[model samples]
Target: MYDIKALYEATSVDDACRLLKEHPGSQVIAGGSDVLVQIREGKRAGKELVSIYMLDELRGICLDAEDNIRIGSLTSFSHITKNPIIQKYINVLGEAVDQIGGPQIRNIGTIGGNTCNGVTSADSASTLFAWDAQVEIAGEGYRRVVPINEFYIKAGTVALEEGEIQTAIIIPKKAYEGYKGHYIKYAMREAMDIATTGCSVNVKLSADKKTFEDVRIAYGVAGPIPMRVPTAENFIRGKEVNDENMEAFAEKVLEDINPRDSWRASKAFRCHIGVVMAKRACEKAVKQAGGDVDDRTEL
Candidate 1:
């Protein structure tokens, strides 16, 4: 049961910021997918909610003057899956969101909520991390953009200050250029299941598409926060995309992830699956970048 002392419908981003400032005990709600669940389960602690679901200013997918893809905080997963801009440039994001839940859940879950929930298993975080996305935040009188990887301080905790709201997510143009990415979520079931482990790989190939120019590898449910494996990425960078190098890269990834044992999966299992998922995701990304992958080869 939702025991709310008050509910304020914010008409704009400014209004939402003002409400948060005025009511320090109030929490912000857009899609309410995560918050409502938390509230019902007695996990979240606020009686007052400032609703930004109706704030049109905080919704949409567009490109800024600098060609950065800006996704409003209130943009739902449904819109994200169908948006041509997302489909064309950052379809890996679309691919991840599409697997989130049933259609109804996707229709109501916002990207902001997914990130703000700050769960290690959030399906979207690893993909966004691979793209090197930035988050735009708005407060009473100031706005700031911070890299997505830096947004999380710990599990279930975000860097948003009091009275601040995330306004949009920004993916720089440079992050998209020559990048082909893939995201994979491993769960017990196909639907309505949180990831036991997830991996996302984005690779930039050389002009000839034979060698990796830049590579990013990230994982979810692998540590205290969504993690990027720099050691594995460094090993793969400038290397030929072949069975031997890919296997070496996969082995090196074990040095980066720090998954904990949970009821759903053991730490050893998570690490083992994480390595496999990374290899598969990397192979898919390499193939998407127009490189040949040998399925017969095992990493």
Candidate 2:
């Protein structure tokens, strides 16, 4: 095991920021679920632990009077999974959180840490991407906001600059008000496997369900990053959820996702699963949008 020069449990945002500046080499830890194991496995190394859990500024789940849900950075996945606001407004996010690791891991892992870690299998990442979520970041001079889709530079790396802390994750109320979505992960096993491929679909459909208004799709574990499926999304928008459109949408997604080597699954299987997951997720999203699509119909 590696050793750390110090461990700081910051009680406030100012205190946390001060400690972070004092030890530039320090790594911020909230849940310590993924990071601690990564450190012990020699995947992540650091000399200090700056605990952000005690920072009251980084803890809580609340709804403002405006109906927008404001989630603190340190909010746990379990907390998010159970939050009624999340359930009612961001069901896809809640669904993704429920499938992460397990109840015990969920209880400790923070939603902010999951996406900030920037791994492709991060359960909540693509869900946020589908919803057009925004991450709030703060640093020395001021704060900045970036859409969730652009938050990661690469695997295991966040776009957050040095000394900056992600203050909150603001999921806009508009994304949730009249829309609905579904998240589907294709994994070998339901319990422990990372997604071979995962998809989240969000849509606003006509009352008759014959046509769609707005549509969004995001695919994970398909490329250098978890990403939005723009080609697939474009094909589904304004199109009827018929067999022809489903096939066209699947073909569209095939153009974008090419899976890579992973210990748990083969590339071909991953590719196949991505296509299957995308189709199913899209259908479910359309249904949730109050669209009248018979899922039993062939694609």
Candidate 3:
């Protein structure tokens, strides 16, 4: 067995940062759901563990001064799913959170841990990336923020360096207003399956019910990272979305997606599902943004 030391608890972000500096071999542990599993599987063996879940500064969610919603790094998936603000507005993100594990895991697994742990299959990440979310990094000397897309360097890899902790996630105000989106997770079963296929769509509604505006679509477990679907997005942007635009967008999904492994689903299955999901999301969002009645909740 590997030798290890547990620091018991951390009271605040400042306290946690200090401990991280003092214990060079230590790894910050919160939500223990992911880290504990890794430790048991021998995927990681750190000399010390600093439990930070108790740190008040690292938990909670709220809109910041700029009206951008900032989700505390330690905020649980349950919190994300239950927050009326998130549900009433950023429904795409709320939908993603709802799919994360069962009730037990949802109560404990956190967004910070999900992003930092860097799992390819993390469901929340796809929506976060789609929104061009930003991350607040806390450290001893200073704090800095980076866009979510830039935060992850690679699969299971991130830009988090020495003495830094992901303190919060910030979603810009505009991304939250006049926005509509849908998230679909193609798993073996809705209850306990990792996404074989997952997709999120975000669209900016034009004041007039005619033209489509900014569209952002993304997928998970499809490639090395969560990414915007460029080809499909471009196909429908600025156009008067209709059955024709949806069909064209669907065609683009086939060309745009870059599938990696085969487990989530066969390449063909994911590609087909990606195209179909994108079309459905685009139609629903366009309808809503234009102030029309479209009762389709495709997710």
Q: lDDT of all predictions, in order shown? A: 0.90, 0.80, 0.78
Cα lDDT tens digits for candidate 2, 72-146: 998998888788888878878888888888778989989888888888888788888888888989875587888
Q: Cα deviation in Å at residue 61, candidate 1?
A: 0.9
Top lDDT prediction, candidate number:
1
lDDT, candidate 2, at 121: 84
**At residue 138, what lDDT does model 2 achieve?**
81
Clashing residue pairs in candidate 2 (N, C-alpha, C atoms within 3 angstroms): none
Provide the lDDT at 220 for model 1.
Answer: 94
Backbone-clash count (model 3): 1
Error of 3 at 234 (Å): 2.4
lDDT of 1 by residue, 49-108 (tens): 999998888889999999999999889999998999998998999999988988998999
Greater-lDDT candidate between 2 and 3: 2
Q: Name every residue pair that clashes in candidate 3.
A: 196-264
Candidate 1 lDDT: 0.90
Q: Which segments of candidate 2 are over 4 A away from where they belong? A: 296-299
Residue 234 miss distance in model 2 (angstroms): 1.2
Model 1 steric clash total = 0
- Candidate 1 vs candidate 3: which has greater lDDT? 1
lDDT of 3 at 19: 83
